[model samples]
Target chain A: MVMRGLVCLLICLNVVGVCHDVSAGMYDEEEGAFETVSALNSDHRFWDDVRLTLSHVYAYGTSESGAIANRSSLRYEFDTTFFKRFSLRLDGRSSLYWKQDHQAGVDDTNALAQNDLRECYIQAGFDAVSFKAGKQVVVWGETDGDVINDVISPRDEREFVFTNLEDARLGQPMVSMDLYSPWGDVFVFVTLDPKVNETPAPGTRYFRGPAGIRVENEKPDTSDQESGIKWKKIFHQFDLSVMAARLRQNTGVLVYDHSDTYKKKYPSYWFYGMGARYATGSLLFTLDASLKRHYQLQTVDISGRYAGSECLMTDNALGVEYDAGGRYTLNAELTHRHIVNDQDDLAGVKQDTDGLFIQYRRLFLNDTLTCQYRFYHQFQEGHTIHNGELDYLFSDHIRVIMDYTFFRERNQRSYYWTYRNDDRISCEIRYYF
Target chain B: MKKTALICLIMVAFASAAAAGQAREIMEKVDNRNDGQTVIAHVSLTTFRYMTQNGKTRAMEQARIKRMTFVKKDEGPREKDHKSVSILREPKSEQGIGFLQYDYEEVGKETDQWMYLSALGKVKRIVAGNDNEPKTGSYFGSEFNYEDMEAYNLDDFTYTLLGPETYRDTDCWVIEAVPVLRKAKKSNYSRQILWIDKDRDMILKAVLFNRNGKKTKIIMSGNIETLDGILVPRKIVVDNVESRRRTVLLYETIVLNRPVDDEFLRVRTLTDKGYRERKLQEFKDLK
Candidate 1:
């Protein structure tokens, strides 16, 4: 559909010479170069432009769970512009995952292959107003290092190689509208997914899905529509955002357990977040507070009617981040999670974690030489996970990266399913045209 | 009735004379003009800037500049000059020199300018009266524009001579010049009053008013010296009224048509870095 539309716009522009306004002054020393190449010089009508991109990625990692994996992905993107107001883009990615058997006794899959649509959207804009419908990535933060790709749901980026989470879905069909005003902007989005299927474990479900339960029959009685509204405003040098959402199904819970003691069944989950960001000169600061209700604890099978089903759980997090000079950044966060139900076989639970992260970077010799160091210490319950990374930029677009991960604590063995000390190193070269 | 009319006429004549006297002092003393066949000078400037916030003064070294100019005939119903300068720092950095030539086509009517920059190695001709593009633009770190050098017509302004006064021991006329064009280009001042020495018509001091009628800039010219029989001010001081900013220019040497070869302004000379270095050394070694 996007390709056809682009072609039609080009044909119309060729019939009319009205598209010059869009390219005027785009080239400082020349006039009509773009028009001469385009078919729109005779009559005045519309304008159009087309661009394409190709990218590839590779990654390798060893998990304490006795699994070694290698992953690769390739992506293609095409963008079309028309009338300087209409834009349509199509993007897709294909991935391959390979894993080695663990030293510990365990049966693991060798390799996996997957393909998914990243973005396929038809968008139109007039001055300050724009509309986009279809599958697209929703980005919300401003800082590149700590904020750029931090939130939102499309697919679990490593789902293909990460067997335990391989079923995680990527894109969803949605309609989004953005309004731009001088003072600020507002965005509204609504997503519809009628074909509901099997639910995943609690704490592991998708953004709008109920804790691991298809609940197809229950959805009809509830609000199955998913919609959210966000308002963003600039105050002084800070950018502030307030967002709210309503979902027909419980979105935050995964697996639920009910003991034979009580015959009870209920939906698990709710999600909410509010954040503020400030950037001045070389300093950046951000604060985020989020809440999750009826969080998943441990689920038990009921004795009678609810025998085959499980319960859901939730948690809350208050986070803050500070970055100095764009070279180094630090983040501190606290989270409190609780299980909703109480039964003879199921008990309420609460877990709290505090984390601190720091990183430093420097570029010398006219940016021809570079170095970086990062450290993160996360304390949960009685356990701590410390991670560090160092990188060097050898050229304008090439870099060598090395990372180290360590886990320490008296209860470390029981804290995480897989905890270990490891080191990794890689080199990459990037080019843009 | 006739007696009263005679008295009124006498009062008007006195008021006019006083006003003219003030205007004459501002121009004739501080800003001395209309003298000599041609005068040239090389000037270097050193600026010290200070700002006061919360009852504390913070001072710092701001900028340095070097310039050369040649003032010529303004008596033959025309005003023209041969001027050139080499900027040594940020505002108007040029690896080489820039030349400026001005010619008054007709009295009170028009003027023309031809500027040649060694970097471009070509001369650009610009119309006169529109000094906005050349003078009002940023030059080096200090604020000085082409318009800042021109002798604007006094008739275009409404003058109020503030009585005869001796400024720095120079008897002067203090007159104000207000623009008739409300939207004149490159003018940040709403009103400007100058103090001119009565003896030489040289401007000595000036006070600039902003759009809000508040004082914005205070300027003083000093170090009176005669070069080639023409009295010239050797030093200039500018103080930003609203800012803790100030600039000072000191003339290093003054000469009248000391003789410059046309070869120095040629395009080939600009491309020859070796020649430029040699020429610069020779200019410095001049007696």
Candidate 2:
């Protein structure tokens, strides 16, 4: 029994049970998981662990005077245990995109709806070791936004930088093994099917290639499966990790194959990376660097199109985060990419590109509202992108997110020049059950 | 007359020091209470807004509930040094999120914490940051801040005993604790008055004053039970007087003195979902 001042809590916890979050499956330290599902929470349904969310998204172009996106989506996710040591997880999403007003591009032949099974994996955990297999995503990096050393899973950049980070990754079939030892933890992953980044289509606003140019995708060498291994350890306030992988690049390298044809080829590259993080009080510093061997580059050829060139390059990102364990936070990172062997001029590529990125976030109203702003600038091309977002929770099961994005360019040779008129404002509302 | 006044001031000082000494001794016993070396608890956190009319307090219609399995163990040589791991089990949007923290007892030392977001599939090291001022963020969006959940250091505050009284039908000693200079700089409260149960040496109720010297919060502990020969407070209610908010933390079940592996409290527990789940299952199986 609570004190007189807390008498309301007793009724809220027992008879009322108004909170929706407490109505589902809850852990029990005594009667175990399933037993508690049957006894408390009062919902003895079979889908006790299943979670579903429905959302609608709309984006209006600020420059093109048209609608950029109108989409409705449903997401379903759940995890359940079948044995004492093994469990299964299934996550999937279905989306429907309605026809929108033309905004410098068209999607006449695109599918109106699609379904994707993001992750369907099974895991078996034992003392000191664990194994997971099936379709999954394995992330590798220390930097928050810079994708310097995160080379494992292929990304879906169909929406440029507007897609949520959680939804930008495309899971691949793989098997991972983890071993936890006294010194550190070791991770190993092998890919059964390798995939490339999903880029914008021919008629899309983000596409830059010449129109009506026939495109062909080259399949990777099935015999040579993509794989990687990582070793990580923490000492005091410092965390260190080293990783290496022999895999195919996710971004397709374009090469002109005569007769108005361009073949999208993904070449095999060897990646070696190391990352470190150190924290002192409210400051956290991160450094991630990687070197790629036989990296594929696009070189201007005699045909005035593009040809593939094998070269070496290095990618590095240095980031600092000031969280203050509070509602206000600041994060900044500097990224640099250099082509060590750039004797051959790579078309539309700078030999050394450096970029600056910064983000600030603040929460209000007991974390029910969040406001964030992000800015990124590429020094070589003098191009910049700014994004401002506001997220508010109307209730435990509903949330609304609004975002505004803008891009600036000083020259026509920058990547953003192709879609410079694509600045837009977007809003999404989601309900969870 | 001057000599007598000085003597009277000295005697008053001596009496105040004696009261302080007595209060410290009592607080020491409260700190040394047998809480067990290892603890596995299922915590249910409920946060809501409320308004008071007359003397009745009614919770608002909207409330948020969060549930997690929390495990803690004393590790380092220091008596107050320990490591803890918590994994959220309810709330579909927050499921699969976990936190690992290693708390240090040494004054001025910082705690090391890591958080893992399943959606990101990354384990990130976070800081107990201070930007000119201490963090005022609530813990899990509840009225309790990170400070309220941490293990206390006796040196941080000076206690003064204010005689004894009967509170809630139990004999209790009223003590006023004021933060020392060093702690005052980082603390949110200027003063705290606690009602200590004379028999159990536990804090039964506390009323805190904000830095502005205004009444801010009231914390009351009830539903006490003896588990494994040790008294434990199963329910705690924190009422934020300023915001008219309330948070109730209920330990649905707590199993103490269980053997917990050190690795279970490591970073692996935050990132390795399968392993963490296995360990959590084992902990739930503990009687």
Assess each prediction's global lDDT (C-alpha) against the native: 0.44, 0.79
> In candidate 1 chain A, what residue range of length 10 has the lowest lDDT sum?
A25-34
How well is each residue in A134-253 modelled by candidate 1, as lDDT tens digits? 886554433222211123443342222122111233445678887766556787887674222233222221122222344223333334455677777755445576666653332222
lDDT digits (tens) for residues A214-238 of candidate 2: 8899877786489999999999899
- Deviation (Å) of A28 in candidate 2: 27
The list of candidate 2 runs beyond 4 A from truth reads A1-48, A101-111, A345-347, B285-287
Tens-digit lDDT string for candidate 2 (B1-287): 99999999999999999999999999998888888898898787778887656655555657777778789998667558989988876655566788888888887677888888877888888786662455677887789987787777888899999999898778999999998988787777888999999999999889999989999998888767788898878777787879888777777778888889887888878876657666766666433
Give the C-alpha miss distance for residue A94 in model 2, angstroms.
1.1
Task: State, as a TM-score between 0 and 1, how close model 2 is to the true structure.
Answer: 0.92
lDDT of 1 by residue, B1-287 (tens): 99999999999999887776656545534333644443434444434356656644344432333333232333343333332424231112232344343333233343333344432333332323222312233233353434455545544455667667877767876677776562233355678887777777777788888766899777777657676567766666666657546555554555554445444433223322333334443444321
Compared with the true structure, the alpha-carbon lDDT of candidate 1 equals 0.44
Q: Estimate each model's TM-score.
A: 0.42, 0.92
